[model samples]
Target chain A: MPETILQTRALSVERGRQSIGLPDLTLHAGGTLALCGPSGSGKTSLLLALAGLVRPRAGEVIIDGQPLWRLPEAGRARLRGRAIGFVFADYRLIDSLSVMDNLQIARASAHLARDLDRATNLLERLGVAPLASIRADRLSQGQMQRVALARALMNRPALLLADEPTAALDEAAGDRLIDLLLDLGRDEGIATVIATHERRLLPRLDDTLFLALPAEAVA
Target chain B: MIRLRFVLQGLLRRWGSTCLTIGVGALSIAGLCLIFWAQSAIPEAVKTRISETDMVVGPKSSGLDLALCCALQMTPAQGLLELERVQARLAMDDVRPFVRMQVPVAMGDSYRGHRIVWTTPDIAPFYGARLTDGRTWRQPLEIVAGSEAARSLKLKPGVRLTSSHGLAADGDAHDAAYTVTGILAPTGGVLDHLLLADLASIARVHDHGGEHDHTETAPHSRVNAVLVRFTSEIAQASLPVLISDSETLSAASPRLELAKLMALARPLIDGATIVSAIFGALAVMILGLSLMQGLNRRARDFMLLRFLGMSRRDLALLSIGESLLITHLALLGGCILAVAGQSVLAGMLASHGLTVSGAVPFREALTLYSAAVVLSVLSALGPTLRMSIARDDEELRA
Candidate 1:
């Protein structure tokens, strides 16, 4: 039996004045799920809430069979650092740091000791090993996204939550990101839930969840 | 490694402001340290100098002037005191028993801005000065240089220096040359800046150009002052009786005169302390404001850090760590500057006949160091709080 990496029941979140009620979901290890909705539909809110970055207004979010919000905020943060990885749309890299440095920061955030070999290995696998010494601020958007993915995978987390990870990239870069996510799922058994408006990505994912219709989306 | 790099780069990002803030902090701490040193050490140095002599008997003038001219050699003699007349008063039945030791000083001359204090060899031990090099003046016209005076004027044993007729360097130079016979070690008192010699040197210089007269018997030409030590407490009380009959002499209390002199200097000391305190307060405010604004400028980056699995507490610590780095650097600079400043101030004071050394007020330094660190932490508090409350779950839209 495949181990369920992510499970949610009756999950709801407040984004601005809109309260979003999400569908029940289950994602097994090495599975990929897509979250699609309109601009103000709280897809990003659900991603944050599921990643334990924000608290849900209702229901339980279970990651690896443990209730996420039942523990204290510190515990949730620790779990987020150790067991989960998040990729932001803008890459969220400290501009002054190099690509390898960004990966090392992830290790520190996870309360893990530095492993230069692990960082080097992750960057090499992402095909940005030559750019490891290059500063994040100088990288192209596609390169930054690759580096961000490498940083997210630095701790080898069980779950990866990405919010529009390919939104800023060109079509070819977007397609490449999709391939990376799928390969990571297939080979590394890293479960992924991506919030994106990309229509082509939906068919590639193992499952899809619609957070809100265009008319249902509210500020 | 990246966190450390960022902490350092954050400082470099605003290099101009960072340098300025560090300079201000250093100046403030150094200034406050100096104020503490000046407030306590100057008066202490002066009191230690004047505590040995009970009274200064000089030609009738203001008691303060007589004490200044005689005991401290800080002022010019108004008139000469007859040696015979000064001795006659000590031989009196009433004043005889009260007199313990008297070093009659024949002044009214100087060499290279240092006072030429001509008395017997006993003045060296009287002022707690020991010979660091060579022996005391045995024959007339031989002299000993105080430690600082030797350093400044470069006078050593066997070096002959010409004396001028007055207390300052601009006075008329005399033809008689006095040979430096010895150098006194530092006494941390008034003795470290004087040129001491026997009374016959002054007598020879004044008695019709006695240049070749190395004799100790050049006649009792003059006595400008007599530094008297009382035999007992009752002897100090008999100062009035000793000077009552004498029409040409006045007794000045060294302790009383020194207190008045320091009292006059109190205002300057207090003003310096206040100005330094104001600067210190201003520096703290600038540091606090700068740290807070720097954090705010990087608010998005901090939020990004939070999203990257860093806890809010960790984010706050990063901000505080930056402030602490700046403060610790400033503290090191301030200490170096303060010690250098103390040494310079001591040199300047020594030239004016008060001996101050480059000794740090340890208690004051420890207190100021603690206060500086505490103030830096307080300054960091604003940025810490701001970082702690910053929301990293920034995306509200889908």
Candidate 2:
């Protein structure tokens, strides 16, 4: 069995009057794990906690044998750059920059050399190479999503995190994105975790975890 | 790379607001540039004229007033010295006097209602003047017209013109027509508006009879003032005392007078400059607020950048870069506009018979550029700090 790339124990997050908890979750290396839940089901909160972007109220997130929250914010940021990639639900591409500059910035942020060949290869594989020089503002929603995905993979991070990656796509496009993501993760031996409410994608996932609403409210 | 794109995209997306900020910043910077150019140019110009005379000796009144009248032709002297007494003083071993007799101003003259000054040949060399056409007055009744005077009077060299007694149209008639012997080049000084001739010509116009005869029995001296030069360095200190002790004479020093005048004027200039700087500060503050307000709209973009692995430091650098870019571009634009405006500024000064030197100092330009950079940095401070401080885990969660 591969080593665990991400492990969380007794994690709790609070926002305003609400709080969510997930106990004892671990994502092993070189696998695809799907986190499925309804809206406000604490799916994003869990992902943010795992990515070291959010500070949990209790417990800790351990990645590669390092306690993520125990490190300083800057150290966590560096780890995020080096060790993980993120695909946001909204496809948050910088609208002012060209597609190529966006990819280059991601590589640079990860402290990787800006390799045009690598960016081009990723764009071509993601079917966005022809639109590389165009501004992000000019791209359609699906195109921006692909570019976002390309940017996330630019640094070849050990782990990839996706937040509702297909929320804006049609059924056909969503299935294709999931297939591409799963195939890419398998081919690259990269650990992948995705937060979604789409039950349709569960059959494709190697493993699945259900994050239900807090037990008191559901009852 | 992504961080830069995000910053640039954020700027472009809000083009209207950004341009407005840049425009306001540019105007403030332009105003500062104008002040910078004028401050350096005015003093240097005044100093250039002052430098031409080693010393100015006149009546006991303000030294600056005497210098302005005698050397720069800006103001008239309060009193005059007797020519013989002046000549006797100049006879000293170290004293060299350059005597000038201002045409006894009668005030009521106008050729077709344009004011004309009746003055002499020595007025040209006394102020280091040159002729644009023809020659200096060689005979009584011959006139050398100032540039504006010639243009207004429509008188060329050899053309004859008449005058009234004063600047007014109803002043006494001179009867005899004075011939234009020369046209002076533009000096951008008081001389640009006067008519030049021999003192004798002015006396003749007033029909005061011959020079020595008119002076010997006359109730008053005809000359307005005399400018003098000294051969020895020590003469300046000694001469004023000597002249002041005389019953009929008092002396003034141009250098001392101008210095005193400048001392008095310094605070006013500094105050006005401070006011201008405050306006610039306000502009920078407004820009900062604008950036801060816009930051809220750009939060999603910033979060995306952060998610792509941009550190907080990169965000700060991006804010600074935007400010610097706007400021430097505005500074360059303001300087070019100032240069273009100089001629109009010089013309306005010339109309008032004030000479402002054409040369703008490099230091002034440097100060302007420095102020722009400083203001840019100051404007960026609020936004940079806010962005840096707000990059916490709670804020990024959504």
What TM-score goes with each of the models? 0.88, 0.72
Candidate 2 similarity to native, TM-score: 0.72
Per-model DockQ: 0.62, 0.37
Which CAPRI tier for candidate 1? medium
Single out the weakest 10-residue window by summed lDDT for candidate 1 chain A. Answer: A210-219
- Candidate 2's residue-wise lDDT over B1-398, tens digit each? 44445555666767777776666666666666667767777666666655545454444565566677665555433555545565565555544443222223212234554445444455576556798899887777788887877887787988988776544456556677889888999765556667766656655666634322222111224344456555555655666666667565556666666767778888987886787677667667766766676677777766666676666776677778777776766666666766667767877765444667554567776777777788788888887888777735555654
lDDT of each: 0.78, 0.69
Say which candidate scores most in DockQ: 1
* Sliding window of 10 residues with minimal summed lDDT for model 2 chain B: B211-220
Query: What digit string (tens of lDDT, one per residue) describes model 1 on residues B156-176?
Result: 899999998777789778777
Misplaced by over 4 Å in model 2 are A1-4, A9-29, A64-67, A111-113, A207-219, B1-5, B52-66, B73-85, B88-224, B230-252, B256-271, B341-375, B389-398
Residue B83 lDDT in candidate 1? 78
In terms of lDDT, the best-performing candidate is 1
Give one digit per residue, the lDDT tens place, for model 2 in A1-219. 887788888877754556776667777777777777787777777777788877788898888788999998768877888788899878888777789998888877766678899899989999999999998889998899889888888888778999999999999888888888888877777789888888888887865454444422320
Q: Candidate 1, clashing residue pairs? A: none
